[model samples]
Target: MNTMTLWHITPAEFAVLAFAALLVGFSKTAVSGANTVSLAIFAAVLPARESTGVLLPILIVGDVLAVLTYRRHAHWPTLWRLFPAVGAGVVLGTVFLLWADDEIVRTSIGAILLLMAAVTVWRRRTAEKEEDPDEVTTRAGRAKARSYGVLGGFTTMVANAGGPVMSMYLLSAGFRKLGFLGTSAFFFLIVNVSKVPFSAGLGLIDGPSLLLDAALAVFVVPGALLGKWAVNRINQRLFEQLVIAATVVGGVQLLVR
Candidate 1:
């Protein structure tokens, strides 16, 4: 397929998508949940359903970059613990997508984005009140992992919106910056790569979508590099607030549009 002809986006739209792609890379390296904004941008610019498929390849690219940058810090046990529940959630999400139309998908994504932002805020506040925020009892940790894993899987499958959910989980579990980034990198890489066949079966991943992904993929690299440089120097609080604000605006736009 001629990608030039297949992708009917205007120059302005392409600029927007390229910016979103850059955010994807930056989010992977610097802040885990920051890409919720990228999700919103993609859904707004492309057909909401099709956007998820196109975004997936770009995400995998970011995931790979993240793994390369933080591979040694990954927590494999956590990944293994979450995978079974995540798998079950993915199946459930597939069923949901099979039944939902474009409008439904769009609205669901908007709602999920808003919910995730709210959840992230709540998690942070609650963690601050705890005596030992990083220490979870064995049973509690397992239950929490299962809950977050399933939700992460569902959101990722439906809207490519799992970043916030997983972010909250890792933060609650008390991971340092590098460990959080590393575990998340591997988790998304495995999960997103696995979603390819499902997305393809749903007709979300096709020749044209792949073509669009190819065009957007290059932008992710420079963004990743920038994120690596900024990760240590950036003010975390200020950046998170911006990410949340942008996510809120995007979510509201999707809901009301």
Candidate 2:
């Protein structure tokens, strides 16, 4: 693994990785679960752990663009409530990554994505029964927040797969469009940036991965711009359905691949 070099990778593989990186930007700005497609693409084309490492930087780039666009609309109280649990979860995930082999990492990421996709579907189907946003401070609501926060951090660290998990939590908490975008942008920017040290220490992000990231990073700008133009034009129900469908397909592909 240490001897792995970019020279061995085919042109087709580079194209896929570049597309995945572009999708990362579009997902961060326009759609939530869309990057799950990128996650699957990266994992399919690269070593499971290595893909996670490379994808983190690209995700952060997208996160920065999203944050810059939505910086003023964030809801900080929710972030404060979730950070402690997220930190603990990140620690746990780091330990897991250190121990797991390639196949195990692949399967675990697939399972987590599938589970989160289910939750997203169930939440949407039962939206009528969902509680008011004002109840976020209540005991049950706080518990829910912490639980999702932990899962979000853990999944993100392990697979760059936190989008669906956080999407569900925010939707459940009733964040409208701008608030949701702003909060998610800041949350992931902080979360992904905090993870750089852990990934580096683990030797997951190295010379070849960095080179690959640099190439893929350039595609994110156009994707982000496209996303911004398209976000308001799409129907909400259609967006949710597409995200759910992409997530499920990605999860199943990971398991089989």
> How do all models score by TM-score?
0.87, 0.93
What's the lDDT for all of these models? 0.81, 0.82
> lDDT tens digits, residues 26-100, model 1?
999987777877887887788777788889999999999999999998988889889999998888889999888
Q: Count the backbone clashes (under 3 Å) in each candidate.
A: 0, 0
> Whole-model lDDT, candidate 1?
0.81
Residue 6 alpha-carbon offset, candidate 1, angstroms: 3.4
Regions of model 1 farther than 4 Å from truth: 1-5, 127-137, 235-254
Best by lDDT: 2
- TM-score, structure 1 vs. true: 0.87
Model 2, position 190: C-alpha lDDT score: 95
- Tell me how far the alpha carbon of residue 176 in candidate 2 is from the true structure, in angstroms, after superposition: 2.3
Residue pairs that clash (backbone atoms under 3 angstroms), model 2: none
Global fold similarity of model 2 (TM-score): 0.93
lDDT of 2 by residue, 63-158 (tens): 999998889988888888888888988998999988888788768877887888888677768777756656666888899888988988888888
